[model samples]
Target: MTESSIEANYNRAKLEADKVDLLIAEALENGCSFLVEAGAGSGKTYSLNQAAAWVQENKWAEYRKNAQSAVCITYTNAAVEVIKERLPENSPVLPRTIHAFAWEAIKQYQSFLVKTVTENLDYMPDEGDFARVDEVRYTLGNRYRENGVQYLYHDDVLKLFCELLDNGKFRRMFADRYPLILIDEYQDSYGPIVEKFVEYFIEPGAAPQFGFFGDAWQTIYQSNKACGAISSDWLKVIRKGSNFRSAPRIVRLLNDIRPDLPQTSAIDGFEGEVVVITNDDYSGSRRNDRNFKGELPPDVLRERLDEVTGLIRGNVLPEETTKTLMITHKVLASQQGYDELLAIIGDALRDEEDVFLIFFKDVVEPVYRALCESDHAGLFEALGVKRYPINKKSDKIRWHELRRSLESARNSKAIDVVNAVVGSGLVPIPPKIEGWMSLYRGDSSTLYASSASIGQYLGLDYQQFVAAIEFLQPDASFSTEHGVKGEEYDNVVFAIGRGWNLYQFDVYAPMITGQVPIPSGKQASFERNRNLFYVCCSRPRKRLFFFVSIPLSLEFRSFLHDLAGEENCYTYGDFLREWPERTIAACVKNGAS
Candidate 1:
């Protein structure tokens, strides 16, 4: 990768963001619903801000007269800020998350909301359902109760609102409140809610004018299609053609991948390095062997990523300039030597009664991280000091001795750490772990992973167990492609294989590379994989590298060479040849503390 360093000159985009903003301004003037197909790094937010400002300036008088404020509906709070910041001071434009927007419509209809929650949904409260929304204590709403408190999931918000769309008066009242509605990142909008919005509002010429703004190629958040009937021809189509992120060559690769919505780079003459690394020769079996599964075995996969990352840091790009992006957290956990923890973690993580989870999260993790940082205050905090002081009152001098003992505990086995935590009499053991006293006494080796793996997991080395738990924490060294969405860097190390059930790159590669025709039945899935791949590829400003594990057919491999250029197509051996002399560099040092 040293040979593929980022280019020296970073010529900023020559194209004006005003081009799209002006188009959006004019589109709003026409008074028709429109969808802006803003591509990656096209400054879609800038366009949105500009459009909202235009609405505020030109339509404020009309909205004020009608007693309505235009609403900018987006998915995340961060996006709401992006739209809200650029609006005029005390502007009539109100930017809100879809959840907040739905809450506004349904909060006044308390009786109706309660009816929808109790009658339509399955989560019936144990003490009988709430009579009012104010009475219902909501952490998030879906389930009727959680931890003896009435609450729900986030999905419940959307579900309740979707149910309300069936009522003509609710739709009319919502339209009366908001004469203009703009949904940014509309592609990832909730499916059922967005569908009902189309049915009740957009399709039938409702009062509010609708504007959907997002790139279909960047809709990688969902496994299936996100924006449903919004793609229909009823809405006026607008394409923001300029890409202000990647260099000229990187844009060319993207254009080849997606010809339908081709991009014009803001850089007129800037060149970029595009390197593709593939392991076509490695022989490793999938844990569950099947033709559909493409990910290498966990250990083998770790080896592959480490070698590739080493080459990338020493040769291709420096650790400071490059960001490593994987497909999922599980994939990254495997690369970090902690994926084994993910198996037990996948099942009922919210179950408070699970002894393993309680021990890991509370006692082990907090103590482990505190010791690593050499913070005695943090250690004491984990021991439930301060507001909840150390329960077992021994000699106060013992706190000093415990620090040294706990620091050395990392060298002991995992079961030993658990026993020390429980036996030290420094902290009261949870009732759940006490209940499992019989299981803990048994030999871990005798317990099967399928039935009794908690003991077996506890039997691992404490160092390894702590490391696994740390990997489960948010690590900046490696990230999922989804995490880096709408983010750009000087260079990127994009590792592509398959870890998730739906992200089948093996099937998607041939379709994009022209080895086979795209199937109609798998069209949604193809788009899903393609959108993710495109999202990863288009993140780098000066240099882009793709390290793929799924062995591609010869024809598709050659197609990659042709697409990326022969000069940039790299083999695994090229990386291995230089590895013996170089030290591996981490993208980020990820000690959990």
Candidate 2:
């Protein structure tokens, strides 16, 4: 807190900021490609935006003279929005998702693509092919017309663009158009086509300067084995090791967990507590407990809930000043388990808004949007209000009425609302909504009936969906590990060993303890488990409580003890015996003070 100490801290922060600027300047100046391995909580996005700004400020004259713009490619549309918001208006930096960027390229070079495709194909397109293309165009809401070839799906556009990029003329044209190509979350970019695109465009001594920003250790996408293959002798590799999100204790724990990806804490000597609680008395055998047997036994589940409840009550203030999160690896593995956790948290935090529900209601959201598209009279009829519209001319008033009705029915069952709307004949049901309902009601024996298939059926990754909806308010204090990434809390209770198909806790637990070597074939799985654990454990800014359902081997217990300290590592039985009294004493002391 001294003046000199404050100045030193300020200087340290400034240097960290400058490091990114220096990397960007070096890559831009030399026209050499680079990859920045920005770890979790590293300001990757901010650095990307700064790089964009640098290009605009320093190279704008050269770019403008050639009618070119600096292009930033993000992993998600949400990321694109963030980058767009951060950049100044008319900054000449084109920020877009990969798909959006591809679509734009298709639009810009439609004529060239048509010519190439026609020349490459053995047979000319017939009316049926054009009919299918028309369907695609309608589906994508693309209305542009060029040489009567006005139809293309997203994949088709990407394929055509890739083909065009292979042509030397088009490749040079693209490089001229985009002199600086920056890809965010590059590790998640996979697929043979994507690999070809990256290789073709980002070749050594290419006209455009390409920079990739990502963490290979955090490449949790199982299908992306090519992520690590992106590195080359010519590519400049920069490592951003300072973690600005977590406390020093959490950073140290992350380093211990994944020594391959060692990170340093930005804040010096920052303190936090890490508690590892295991259910050593669980009845399941190691062989049978790989997936935690899908659900915990009744008593064990109660004990786990009790530990979570006690932690929240003891460490979490009633005033809700400090944020708290309870993360589980499985959010929808067992509906019964999910409901029980919600019930327990609701009862414990009665009338408190701290326990927010995070879920992907994508299956329901589009239906709701469709229902809301109806006019006021139709919506009222659907809701059984039997009210006539007072102002027929104003669509805005009708929209407000529809919004209020939909808002009030937010918690209603999707089936009931859909039935009401369809039965009332308010509006024609969209085909997409009907298709979704069909999948939801599909045969239990079908692939879509399985819990693992729901996400794919709904056109989303389940973990990503859970992460996207963390802000929605609901009557629960539960979230998936993926959902809590990059988010901090004062208190965190993470439930591991849940039956998530992707995470093999049996394999991971042993790997963590050094009991077994991570199989070369399953290295991706190992890295994913490590990354998820790191993300969950590092979320707590002050206190972390980990509850593992399966019985832990002695080696695993020792591993937990080493990371959390023996004083903080406790068996479920030990915690139950000691924590209640400690909780009571703390509450009494706080009251007395």
Candidate 3:
């Protein structure tokens, strides 16, 4: 807390940042490939943007002389937009998702791909293959026609591009087209595909420079193995250790909890409060009882809500600034988890419908209704028909006449329907409609099945989606740990419980306190919970309160006391005893204010 201590922390953090800057400079100046293991709050995005800017400033002149542009690939569209906005207006950096980049390649090589596949393979064109590109479904086998061009499936487009990269000629051409390639969130990239890309493009020195930036510890997605598979030996690998987001106290808490990760420090010298409340008195006995299955009892859930309510009322400044984080590991296990969550959060909730519901409302129902009404104009308008040419020569065409002609031609297959709609030339194929066609191209039964009739089949998905959406609302006081990543608040009340399938506080307590190693079969569960807890705890800018469903072990309790100070650690009973009734009701009704 002293000025000297703050100065020391700031100096140490500066050294770490300088080290990262040096590594980036070395890679950019030497035209070498590099990978950075950026820890939480290490400013990974900033580093990536700097690298991109360096590429544009240093390597872009030569690349432009060769008619090529630098490429920056990221995992999410939002990230791409952010990076795009940060780069200079005339910068050569072309920010895109891996899929979007693959689509561009497919468009450029469509003719060549048509000739090569047709000449080299035994292609069978089915009725469904009418005018589509060779559909390369990764899970499904590749389908190509021996003669004509077809639209490429999303996965197939990536597959063909990877295959083309394997060819020496295509690899050189691609390298020439993209002299510098920087991948953000590289740890989340698909393993096999990235491996192939590295082998053909990076390792062979095909591209002038390459950069991969991401935090391996934050690899929460299932396909994380690919991140580890990337060869660290060939690239200049750097580990960035300073924390620029969280307070110093939070940084220290993360250090204790996730000591396995790279060492980190809070560069900003900000100090904040960390509170730990044990549920041992309430749920202690049931902690180790695996046989005790199902949702937590209502009394226990109510007690948790009461504790959160009290904290929000007393500790949260402006009360409305409180953010409560809960976890639902098995949202679809049963509706019980979501129901309990809703009941606990009460009125502080806002929900959004899932993608399927939105898609059904926006596209499917309209198209289906138009088809049934035999209104060609209505159908075309619903399809968002804009620039494609129509064959009728007349301003309007009767649906009955068109349907009769199509039926007489025996084009009744689902693919036939898609082709008629798409090939009609009256409407340009939109991405959403194309996606729908892809989903039911081979089987149209689902297309004709009305949403009303198929409600049962969609019931669970719809419920989960709505719950997730509500939990994610910015104005809502409550959210799931997974939903609150990358979000920060003045006060955060994190609830740890069992309904989330594997996230039992009893098991997590031991692992967190170093009293027990993560069990063999439960490594995945343990790591997930660890990451979730880390994310939730680090979200509070000023104060953090944890509410565990079960009691902490003696060792875990002592560990918490030491990490967050004895005054900050309390039993749930003690918390209730100290807080007044009105505060509790306020939290339960409208959140902690």
- Which prediction has the highest TM-score against the true structure? 1
The sequence of per-residue lDDT tens digits that candidate 2 reaches over residues 1-593 is 76666345334644775776697778778888888888776667777877888887888788778788888887777878888888778777889877678767656664565565455442234333342121123135343434455455445565665666677887777777888888888877645544665577555556677888877666655643435437567678877766666666777777777676566565543355577778776566343455456456645565566555555565445643233333332333232233332332332222222212211233234434545675544445443446553446564555455455545544443344454444444335557556655666674233433242432333332233233233243433555566565567656677766566677554575586466688889876776786666667767655577777665666666667788898877777787676656555544444343
Candidate 3 backbone collisions, by pair: 132-150, 132-151, 133-150, 133-151, 280-551, 312-592, 313-592, 319-593, 389-425
lDDT for residue 332 in candidate 2, whole number 0-100: 32
Per-residue alpha-carbon lDDT of candidate 3 for residues 1-593, written as tens digits (9 for 90 to 100): 76766477667776888788878978878888888877777778888888887777786677677788878888878988998888888788899988788766555665667665555443333435445455222222344332344434445556566667667777767767777778888867766667876776667665647788886656555533445326746677877888766667787787787675545555443455577776656643352435334334545665566556655556434543677666653322122235532332233323323334344334433554565676657666666765432456462464444344444332232234345545545434657566655655554445323332122223233343334444444666676676676677767777766664656655665687577677878876876666566677777765677766554567656766777888777677776775444233433443221
**Tens digits of lDDT, candidate 1, 1-593:** 33223321222232445666776777789777889988787778878877887888899998888889989998788878877777776788999988888877676676765555556545455453355434333345445643434465666666678878898888888888888899888888888887886777777766678888898778877643366326655578888777788777888888888787777777533466677777766665655554326667777777777777665556533433667888876677567655565555544332333466557667767865775686668878777766534445564345445555666665876666667666566656778666555566764444534544657666656665555555444434567777788788877888878777777665676677577689879888887888888888888886787787777777667667877787666567765764324322322221110
Candidate 1, clashing residue pairs?
1-315, 1-316, 2-315, 2-316, 140-152, 141-152, 141-153, 142-152, 142-153
Highest lDDT against the true fold, candidate = 1
> Which runs of model 1 end up more than 4 angstroms from their true locations?
1-16, 81-89, 114-139, 145-153, 222-225, 267-270, 281-288, 291-297, 316-321, 347-404, 418-457, 464-475, 481-483, 513-515, 578-593
Candidate 2, RMSD to the unseen true structure: 9.2
My TM-score estimates for the predictions, one after another, are 0.77, 0.69, 0.67
Mark the regions of model 2 whose C-alpha exceeds 4 Å error after superposition: 1-14, 111-150, 191-194, 201-203, 223-229, 268-270, 282-290, 318-476, 509-515, 576-593
Error of 1 at 427 (Å): 9.2
Question: Candidate 1: minimum summed lDDT over ten consecutive residues — where?
Answer: 584-593
> Of the candidates numbered 1 and 3, which has the greater TM-score value?
1
